[model samples]
Target: MAKRIAASLVHAIETLFVIAAVALAVALLLPRLFGYTPYAVLSGSMEPELPVGSMVYVHETDPTALQPGDVVTFYRSDGAVVTHQVYEVDAEARTIGTQGIANKDADGSLVHDAQATPFSGVIGIAAFCIPYLGYAEAFCTTPSGLLAIIAVLALLAVASLLLGKSGSRRAGRRARGCGNDG
Candidate 1:
């Protein structure tokens, strides 16, 4: 009974570990796999919900597909990127009015009032946001961080190969022990 209980606990632990590993892999790969582009917030314009340093995932979208209240990212004439919620959409004119959640007015005018963005200026529609993830992303792109990542990947590959070899050897020994002749 004790041996059976121990075996069951071991199996449960292994299952949990597998689940955790798979979840990590999905979290790391899903964005690129699904065509989502990540952008980091540089200002507090979006405020409480999407604070500065937050990372947002945006997906390519058609101009006609957007609706009021949808958050989007687009470029200004000077090529600066801005992310804001859509205030209104004019399908016929193919233009969109936007305002940052935290922004009230810019230079005494309602934000984006002077120039409504044309469809061609739209980059992508905001999909999701993760606060502070932008810092981690920025770090990972640095020279030292990239080297550390490569080193860790190499270590993991070596460990897995060694573990596989050791496991096979252990199984072989057990098989040999069961033979009639040593």
Candidate 2:
């Protein structure tokens, strides 16, 4: 009975580990698989909806297809990427005016969207945003985080190898004991 319970526990753990590994792999590859770029938000300009340190996935989109009320990511005059809600789209002039839903600063007290960003300056349209995931991205670049990832992969490999060997040893013992006992 104890052996049965132990087997069950091992099976459960292996299943959970596989599921978690697959989920993490998919999340990491999703952007590259679907023409999306994950950009981390560094400011609270688009706060409340897209809080600071969130990760937003942007997809390449035709600027002409953009319309008012749509949120977009565009390049600023200084070449910085900024994501905000589109307030106006001028197809003739190939420009878009965007504003933050909750931005309040010395440069934004005039009650208007930002200067019309040129269509050529548009980077991509915001598809979705995951809050606080930017912290993970930052951590991934750190030495500790990299070491942690390596440790996890090594642990997984060792666990799988141990499980495989134990199972094979049990099978061999069972085969030897299969003969009739006097």
Candidate 3:
């Protein structure tokens, strides 16, 4: 009974792991194939709709095509990348005003200020977001995280080999008893 329970537990774990792996691959890789750049959310500026630790996929867009209420990602003069909702667009000047949802004020008090990041600084507009996936992306970049991933893969490989051997042994035993039903 204990052996059966152990086998069942292992199968359950393997099934869950496979499901998670597939979901992650689709969320991370599928967007890249379509010209979407993925950014990990590091702040709660756009909270409620886009919580922190989410993975926001962005697609390149024309500045003139942007309108109020559109979410955009752009770089500041200091090279800081920011994602915020468009508050206004100045076609003649080729700049857009943005503000965080959680903020009480727009990114800049004046449209001509740093908050009005130029069209040239625009990286892209956010297409979609996957909540809490950014944590996985951040963790995977660390040395310890890489080691942990390698260890898990190794364990899975070892488990698969062991399971395959046991399955073959069972098949062999059944074949030997096929004509010995006396």
Q: Ranking under TM-score, best-scoring first? A: 3, 2, 1
The per-prediction CA RMSD against the true structure, in angstroms, equals 7.4, 5.1, 4.4
Choose 1 or 3, whichever is better by TM-score: 3
lDDT of 3 by residue, 100-120 (tens): 876654553423234588999
| Runs in model 2 lying further than 4 Å from the true structure | 1-25, 105-114, 142-182
Clashes per candidate, residues 3 or more apart or on different chains: 0, 0, 0
TM-score of every candidate? 0.58, 0.62, 0.73
Report the C-alpha lDDT of model 1 over 24-101, residue by residue, as the tens digit: 446546897898878888888888868887888889999889999899999866788888889899998999998877
Q: Which scores higher on TM-score, 2 or 3?
A: 3
Candidate 2, residues 1-182, lDDT tens digits: the string is 45446656666766786786576456556876999888888888888889897989899999999988788998888888899989888999989998887766678562445478999999889999888776667676689988987887686567667766766777787789963323
Candidate 2 C-alpha RMSD relative to the actual structure: 5.1
- Poorest stretch of ten by lDDT in candidate 3: 105-114
Q: Best candidate, lDDT-wise? A: 3
Better of 1 and 2 by TM-score: 2
Model 2 clash pairs are none
Give residue 41's lDDT in candidate 2 (0 to 100). Answer: 86
Candidate 2 TM-score versus the reference? 0.62
Best by TM-score: 3
